[model samples]
Target: MSSENRTAGSGRLLTGLAWAVLLLGLWLWGREITDGSESGSSAPTTGDVAAVGRPPGVALPAAHKPLKPAKPQRVDVPSIGVTAPVVARGLDTQGAIEPPPYETPHTVGWYGNGIEPGAPGTALFVGHVDTETKPAVFYGLSAAKPGERIRVTRADGTIAVFTIDDVQVFKRDRFDAQKAYGPRDKSRAELRLITCGGAFDRKTRGYTANVVVSAYLTGVAEPRAG
Candidate 1:
């Protein structure tokens, strides 16, 4: 096994999500569907903000119509140099969506029980920011800026392309799962990528905040040839 496959410490990347689940009821009421438009505003000035809006002067593409429900086979964030396979994951006993196993830090975990990627709802994807000995697939997720692209290749062979609209790092104390995980627009297909962020707290055995990157479906590519 490579160094990236080494077991992580007791501090799991899902600690922030688990804490959110405890405080906000997570998938229950916290997953409330909401509607809104993409505002071309400046990013949040502070790391504690619940949600960041698109930076000014960044013209993002118009949203593409939602596609048929299809499982995501892979995810690629070119700006961050991320390209990883996606696997279905369910909520843990604590009600928090489980992340990819420590042994597979390069993989991303999709919420299998929720809306599929490219569908008309918010699709959630989670991954580790780093393993015990190295950075994982989403380690550079926080550096992803608005207007960048996130491509999710679906099992149907089509690639659902999403344009980043917001990126926020919510402090654990102020984390709002509803606003952070909920759909920004009910009419458009949205996606959320989450990972641990901020300073790691040895006392708590976790990070101090959660980085949530928001994007909406803006384009679709034909199935790649085998």
Candidate 2:
């Protein structure tokens, strides 16, 4: 081969080698990330529903009757001025809750094994505030405060009213799953709202804290007979 042709061939070989190295590095980096567990960084903290220990904020006797599904249709709280649609589902892998569909727009997560809203015990709901991709449904949840009036309208055209007792923020790892799932005063069913909060980690692209809203059912609408 002539000198110029030989030089051109060498250049192509170098380019191919560089591309191979780049692909190898990317694969190694992805493997390390997937194999490494994300522990310690997600320990639940105060304000987490899990913080509710054997002695909860307010504990009562076992539920009088087993919980039944009250499938909610709409939710309204005069206190925070939130009137959103209700969508209820089971838990997600991350353990954060989802929200119902409202004009505001967001997925509301529900507890699969817990009491259904309008049931005889506490019901649970959760949603995300913001992810790296999109903002979650419960993004405005932090704005809620105590003494707020919350109302949920069911598919049956019945409305259930709840009073916001308080709001708290807990670390991801310190989240108390038990407290979130435990029964409340037992007089009326309750609802707990959850979402990501606290410090934001750019590296992990997630919130270190979780916001929880504790509310109790004040009134339940009687179902209409078929």
Candidate 3:
């Protein structure tokens, strides 16, 4: 793996129909990351007041540890104040990991055929950066930083805590699907929060890059449910 992290910039450009088709074709078998887009860095207002946005500076965390398998239910990122439901998604007719429908813009989709979130592998989770009317669940993902916590509430009633390690925005033409989706730590429980990012080219009617937020499981907890 390369020991470099690339900083990102820019915003959304996908049209309604194009966005839908692109997202649906994202997970095609043996395919790499082809397209995505999102808004520029913005302060998070979803979690606690103290959980404001931080710069994605030169920071790294300890190696992530792997854990037993568990089905995911929801995801919470307090630093960015993101709390959203998760839905299991499989490949579409075109053999791509289908994305959540546009109507359910706030929901995220996890690859159902892949390893579970807490398992000993990189669990892939994705969401739309925006819609025709507004930003989606992952709209603010560009603001995440290393060492922040990403909590995944599972069906077993336990929460899998992952620590952010890196965030990168790869240009569409330079995007590497295998490298982007492959496990950096094969034995550790890792996570990648992906969305569209980078400059929006009005001429192409699409985003010029994709935002990737990489993290790994550090611990597990059983917090009381409200």
Work out the TM-score per prediction: 0.84, 0.58, 0.75
lDDT of 3 by residue, 5-95 (tens): 1112122322322343344356433344332111023332232212323354746556546666788999998997789999988766665
Off by over 4 Å in 1: 1-9, 12-25, 29-47, 50-53
Ranking by lDDT: 1, 3, 2
Prediction 2 TM-score vs. true: 0.58
In model 2, what is the error at residue 123, expressed in angstroms?
0.9
TM-score, predicted candidate 1 vs. hidden true structure: 0.84
The 10-residue segment with the lowest total lDDT in model 3 = 1-10
Ranking by TM-score: 1, 3, 2
Kindly report the root-mean-square deviation of model 2 from the true structure over all alpha carbons.
Answer: 16.7
How displaced is residue 203 in candidate 3, in Å?
3.5
Distance from true position, residue 208, model 2, in Å?
Answer: 0.7
lDDT by residue for model 1 (120-143), tens: 988888888775667778888888
Regarding lDDT, does 1 or 3 come out ahead? 1
TM-score of 3: 0.75
Colliding residue pairs in candidate 1: none
